[model samples]
Target: MDLLPLAVSSVIFLLVSVFLYSWKLNSSGTKLPPGPRGLPILGYLPFLDRNLHLQFTILARKYGPIYRLWLGSKLCIVVSSPSLIKQVVRDQDTVFANRDPTIAALLGTGGVDIITSPYGPYWSNLRKLFASEMLSHANLDASYVLRRNEVRRAIRNVQEKIGTGVDIGELIFVTELNVVMSLLWGGTFEGEKRDRIGAEFREKVSKFIELLEKPNLSDFFPVLARFDFQGIAKEMKDLLPSFDEILDYVINDRLKIMDSEQVEGELPSAKRGKDFVQILLDLKEQNVAEESMTLTQIKVLLVYSTTIT
Candidate 1:
């Protein structure tokens, strides 16, 4: 007889039983928002339209302002009312502040970056660092010259290419790239090296965004994460090292310069132009302890700041 199919069926039956039993136990006396009953195991995922927002609106109209959806095993609560959003975001902000990050996002940030990081001391410290050090008025003023120079360069380049026509998107991207790199490292590449760096950065950022947006089975089924069904995790892991190497090169180059200056007895005050990395390294040297920035953290922040902008 076919014992294999029978064994699989038995396992599935037991899993469903356990799932329902636990669900019943937890939900016995609780009232959940109304939602469409979905098929076993898959939930409402397979039935969702490509226009998810439209679908959500339709569901909200039928189910009232707030509704619940079971996407695979994940339970999603949707609130469409402005008052409810205000209550969640402003009135009781701390209660709902933490995020349940997807597998891809978790992998991308390594569970350490500001965006996907859970609400805690670490996130608070990072927020303070960003506000007090990175995006402070003084720092913005200091970066004005760099920003002005890059903007002027972009304008001049576009002016030169006016008659032939230029890709506005590409122009803006290049200009932004130059400005961000200048702020981060205070150095610019030239000729082939510049072209190569630009291509590399663009490629990696594209891949990162693509991976982030792609629906992975691992995200839907946490137990199946190790299998990496869509290979998004693998692609992300591979993409990360290249980004690390580039950041490492910039950091090491600056460190070498700083070391040479130190050897010549140059004080920290004597350093010419200060970049974001240098400022972060100084903070690291101050032994911020639990709030201290690591090399990985620095690189991650750099990526976050540039790409997010």
Candidate 2:
């Protein structure tokens, strides 16, 4: 009786092990684009180079244009070649237009920004407003004076530092940040204040980008999502206060000017510049606006415009 029971237990263990192994293999075995085998859990994360574009180009040479990479458990399709990119992005535009709603996008956007919004009327309205107002040629022309002045200032500064040993990349980054700040704020700062604000804002923006780019295990492995291995939630909590502080300052400054005009009951023409904040405030006053449109929305829009430019 003892021998029979032992034999039964041994058989059961062998069968269970085989079943689990087969299940795991099958779960990982989907019809995906061919590429290197990812490690168990980490995926092909280790193989990824810091310069993603160049790395993808190199991979395209070996795995073709539309190769798949295992980012954690998620299957990431990489389209490197122009022809393939066009085919996926332009030829099948609608199918590719929607945001994927990954954890990173959700956290970065705070579930409201236009780019990360789902396809619907809300997104349509936001897109139309963005396209017609911010991206319009007229607005660009209006904003050109600010851009020109900032560029001139940057060129002069660069020329002054030509003989000195300086990192060109840092100089360019500062110039770009200054241009964006001028557009958003309707003025530029100088001296200590400029340096301090620039440093803080640059650090915040870099942290934001880093968080967005970091691989979340939850995105790949649904089961591991519960564990939050990437610590994305924690990172977001740390970054949110700084992000909110910057937005609050911009919003408060704009509001102060608007409030002062209202108190004086005067149409202050000289105080007017067609900045994004001004445009959004006007939209808010008009009441023909979507419910999702808020101060937060305006801030996010400004950020997107700056990043894109």
Q: lDDT (0-100) at residue 59 of candidate 1? A: 93
Q: Roughly what TM-score does model 2 have, to 2 decimal places?
A: 0.75
lDDT of 1 by residue, 236-279 (tens): 88888889888787788777877877898886424344557777
Q: What is each predicted model's overall lDDT from 0 to 1?
A: 0.77, 0.72
Best by TM-score: 1
lDDT of 2 by residue, 1-309 (tens): 469999999889878866664465467667656676665555688888888988888888898877877776566788887887898789987677787776766877776777888777877777877888776787666667667767898889878987788787987877787777666655324467655765677678778777777767677677776678779867867887887787777677777777888899965224344566666676777755666467778777766666665
The alpha-carbon lDDT assigned to residue 127 of candidate 2 equals 80
Model 2 sits at a Cα RMSD from the real structure of 5.3
User: Which residue ranges in model 2 land beyond 4 Å of their true spot?
Assistant: 1-65, 155-169, 188-199, 262-272, 288-292
User: Lowest-scoring 10 consecutive residues by lDDT in candidate 2?
Assistant: 266-275
